[model samples]
Target chain A: MNRTTELHPFSVPRYPSGNPAQRVIVQVLVTQDAGQQRHAQLLARADTELRHLALPQYADEAALGEALATLLSEARVGVHLELHGDEAFIWSLCGVARAAGLLGDEITLQCNESGRRMLFCVHCASLQAGTCADLQPCRQCGVMLEVRRHFSERLGAYLGVCADADQPYAQARP
Target chain B: MSALDARVGETRLITPVIREVSLMPVNGTLPAFSAGSHVQLHLPNGKRNAYSLLSDPGDTSHYRIAVRQQAQSRGGSRYVHEQLQTGDQLKISSPANLFPLHSTARLHVLIAAGIGITPFLAYCTELLRRGAAFELHYAYRAGLSDAYVEVLREQLGEHLHLYESSARRLDLGQLLGHRPLGTHVYACGPQSLLDALREQSLALGWPAARVHWEAFAAPEPGVPFVVELARSGRQVAVGAEQSLLEALESAGVELPNLCRGGVCGQCRTPYLKGDVEHRDLFLAHEERASSLMPCVSRGCGSPILLDI
Candidate 1:
């Protein structure tokens, strides 16, 4: 016999009828090795890996879009992919229906490639149709690149995610 | 498992079956415990209740806990104080320490109000045995109605200050006036007293970190709010209508809570983000910025985030 427990009774409601389109913001952090002088090569390699995997296709857009009709259903989930390096890379992949541009929704990911451990957001979505240009500089600090490398050799790379456009990335709060 | 059993022993009536009931390990192997450690009592009815260990840690023959019958209690305390027998065998969890005595301090000031004296009594015994400098301020109603007065007086002697609040009030400011520097103040009492002590201690320049506290009972419930469990991604509605603990329990979050009254800090979780109207008697004033007791406190506004 199976004893199934209903963890939550309340469910997310779908968007109101005739409501406007919605958008979601995404962020990613990529770390690069200090020994490697060519940062662009590393980024290109990662972009290739992301395109090859195509998580958006794996998620089954039709089913996910149906689920997104629920009010509690989040449009995007944040993903973090960490690489071995002293410099940390951060990326944001915002998913917006072509009609809604950007709706101030954001997701964060923290990845540890060495430990093979990754943390992902449950309610958010990954980008379905967007190029690398859609991924701009850090939204919060306006840093030029996705990765922020510290001068010190000891400190490793880190990533952050946020929902508000004004405050895109926040440092981890204890 | 054996080690846990060895620590909790058998149940015995330290006073009488109806008034005061005590449980000790039958194996005579009570674990080495600190001043404010508590044990989980597995009653004959199969329900578990956490009780503060009230005896000297050095005494291995038995581990003692006192139970008072609450007329309206949800049966845990009522059963132990009313229905349980002197020699009844009870399955008990090993001793767990949350309200531990600070050993680093040179002087320890312990303040207990009403039944909150249980943990301090054990601390007194340990301090006396170790020749540690300590003072115990016990506040309770006057007359023969006060429990453990005789034993406390006999054991603590000059170190014990009995403030019968029924006749006079406990002047916290006056009592704490001469408190020496580096004296660690530990208090466990009613919410009003704890709140007053917390406010006055900070006003008087006592470092917020040095003051330690524990609550003996849950605070009165207040208005409820919606709580968003960050991990499960579920929004649980909680308020004065129901406790946060009950709300979470109903939502199917398995919180390892023993005393649902906020006395034990077992259910403590990090406040990822949100405003909480704290109703618990535990937690020093300064600590409130970082921690909260979900058992009694309710969210003040929408979507109080919790890292449970």
Candidate 2:
């Protein structure tokens, strides 16, 4: 029961604040759903001091992942990330941001979801795409997995396991 | 103190399913434990269950724990409900905290759900004593049970927000509003609630450092399996309800462990073979591939070849 070795960014000394000339913030806006238009507008109108590289509605969400890396590679120490868009896209971008050594405290995100999202299977250790919130056949293993609220950080998706282990043919609720 | 001897001072049904048991030291005062500390009770049924210290951290006179009769009782909760009573002497491990509050936070956001409210009871008291700015948000399905809501309501007062689960869900988005720098959030509750907090916190751009969680649920039981001590070459059969720690200890092998709930990495051991059903939160992604916590974790099937 010793202390966890998970590094906390809060404990790390702040990398200096309030120098707008030195501070370069990266604004990653993945405006996939039309519903996210207002959020995009808000981020654009919110601040004008910091220079931004706005990536809006990339052809594919996966393409935005590569763009995030290039941005972080060239990003300065004072650089912060502001993510505004769909939940899935924002989450993937957040994962990308995390992979690039950006902590949650150093970023700003306004996220929205459209019900169906990508989920990771904890049992099969695979990703299931376009899965709804309700009970459905697991895309990977066909275990009739129920998407549980358990989210695995490593997998970057909600953990879905066998829904009805006891009963063979019980209808699951949403 | 060797699993400090304790007598159940009082066992009251705080709610129909939730039983609040007060444990008094057989002698005088017990060792001091901070808020968020929990004790592992060695029940007569040979099952060890970890319960959060529901009493205030300042008070060392006695320890209190609220045990909810789990729907899927694996003997521990059932034993506490049906067998345990006042004056019953029970063996309990020294208090250990896996969910200790961060020392310095400009603002504390405490979230709890159902029986998970036990840990926060002590946290709320400790925060109030220090006059720290904090808030406790307790989520519950109405009419099910109010384990510590009434008590916490009186203690937390204005700082408590009771979130009810229904069609018009408590806007978790609004619940976790604009983060103002040094706001550290601690959550202890069901996986659903914790998962939402974790996903939402990140979505709202809260750092992994500021967001902390305590998975206080009883260890999910796996199938009966065997353990092979690699060094000694001894094979021990673990029963369906037995933890690998208990099985190891039963076979006269001493394994160091603290916070048997899997938060502490004390019992984490490297495994040579077997598919480990890792139920612990201690091991990181990379470590989980190789190691398993024997306290709350178990092998999926077959034999777990431990490097112990």
TM-score, chain A, candidate 2: 0.65
Each model's fraction of native contacts: 0.00, 0.04
Off by over 4 Å in 1: A1-174, B1-19, B26-28, B44-47, B143-145, B219-254, B263-308
Per-prediction DockQ comes to 0.01, 0.03
Q: What is the lDDT of residue A145 in candidate 1?
A: 31
Binned by DockQ into CAPRI classes (incorrect, acceptable, medium, high), candidate 2 is incorrect
Residue B272's lDDT in candidate 1: 77
Q: Please give each candidate's TM-score.
A: 0.50, 0.65
Off by over 4 Å in 2: A1-174, B166-168
Candidate 1 per-residue lDDT over residues B40-127, each given as its tens digit: 7765553456678887788866777877555455566777666677666667767777788876566788888877888887898889
* Per-residue lDDT of model 2, residues B1-308, tens digit only: 25899999988887778888999999989889999988989898888888999898999999999898988887999899889989999899999878899875767888888888889899998999999999888877666656766777888789988877763355566877654445678888877787888777656545567778888646666788898989989999888877888888878886777677787788778988888888877788889877998888888766788897
Scored against the true structure, residue B126 in model 2 reaches a CA lDDT of: 94
